[model samples]
Target: MKRVLFSAPSVRRLLLAALACLSSPAPASDRIQIVTEELPPYNMTEDGRLTGMSTEVVQAVLEEVGVQANIQSMPWARAYDIALNSENVLIYSIARTRQREQLFKWVGIVAPMRWHLYSLPQRNIQLRRLDDARRYQIATVKQDAGEQHLLARGFAIGKNLQSSNKYAHNYEKLTLGRVDLWIANELNARYLARRAGAEVPVPVLSLPDLADDDGLSMAFSLQTSDALVERFRQGLKTVRDNGTYATIAKRWL
Candidate 1:
């Protein structure tokens, strides 16, 4: 084989081309990361597959948008942090709140949810108002909308608020008398109680002040491009308009 050498200018051009290739960003679809937690009826891992109401809705939107992504299930806190700090990240079935309005680019609503303060019937807990419950310890998931809402209203961790990593843990705490109240969404509370082979806990107080009337939504990290976010928003709208959203909701809700 004959040895060949490039000219000085040619070598500089080649280096520049290589560096550009190395530094260029990946395609939007390739960089996108989808995450969720095991908040059932919305998102869950069953038989090694990720499936739920919101999961199905998200899948439908992905199909509508012609984007393919695998959903990963993890603890809510970890998932929330990843979505909050990472680029091109998508989190589904997250409650849309005023506190989180500027944190991420909104995609669209996934499901309706109502926050409530729950207690076992035997406990007979009564709450005439939000402040009335401050006397008792409340169970909440760390970084969850419920916890954030309560914290905003003066519920301090290790004081009157007991934070946990999982929603199931909160249920366990409430049933074992470790906590006086479990602040949660109505659908999630009912699902957890019934799945544990126990009677559904009583919704002692409706948290209208902290209610997320806009419902749960699929959101992309703030670093995502406006075009990509709009694609997902339109995809979600397509699913809702074409009845795919309702079909999924009817099956799960």
Candidate 2:
């Protein structure tokens, strides 16, 4: 015959406890922040929103697993630097290197690339070995994998002619003889040649496997909790096992 509520002091205490728990981040959740560059066919913006093959793939995987994360677009160097120091931030589409092999926890393969060296017509330098690069100055976009790969291999590269406009100006550097050779991805070189109305080599030279570097994946922050990394890894395996990853890959590639 009577309905009574908890005492005022008791109710107040309960509310405060609940609020504290809600405010605290999940043990596995580190408030993830992702930074990506404007590399086309991978990460780029459309109508001021982030959208591309790698971008879409990462967003989908995170959403499927119900993780709260944000992706930011910025210059490649800046993004990479920030990701290195910031907690829970990852630089997507990163290449694997001996120096970086054990640094970050990788999630899933996002994309693959077939790298090539492009030369302007009539000036194509022959390359049969990695040592062949030493004889000529190579061109690459700044802080790009190509740049890192070449420089690390002890080849002298031209000034960091790398930019988001890599495709547009790279050919000029080679054609005008600014640099001896330019390294480019197959798709990007073709895209640029078509837009510039210039001719790219009929057959791009393949540099013997500096690194496989295929399969783009999220690189979890070193500061990210192991539990979170493991969770994402598990989630990725689930997606892959179910063919969800392949399905998503087909949508873009």
**Top candidate when judged by TM-score against the true structure:** 1
Find the 10 residues in a row with the least total lDDT in model 1: 207-216
Please list the C-alpha lDDT of all candidates, in the order they appear.
0.90, 0.70
lDDT of each residue in 16-100, candidate 2, tens digit only: 9999998987554646888988766677777989977777777767876778777998876787777677788767877665556
As for candidate 2, its clashing pairs are: 110-216, 111-216, 141-162, 142-162
**lDDT measured at residue 168 in model 1 versus the true structure, 0 to 100:** 92
In candidate 1, what are the lDDT values of residues 1-253, reduced to their tens digit? 9999999999999999999999987575546999999998788889999998889999998889888777899999999999999999999889888899889898989988888999999988889999999999999999989999999988899999999989999999999999999999888998898899986789999987674455788999998999999999999999999999999989987
Which segments of model 2 are wrong by more than 4 Å?
Answer: 1-30, 157-177, 194-198, 201-204
In model 2, the Cα lDDT at residue 33 comes to 84
Local error of candidate 2 at 8, Å? 7.8
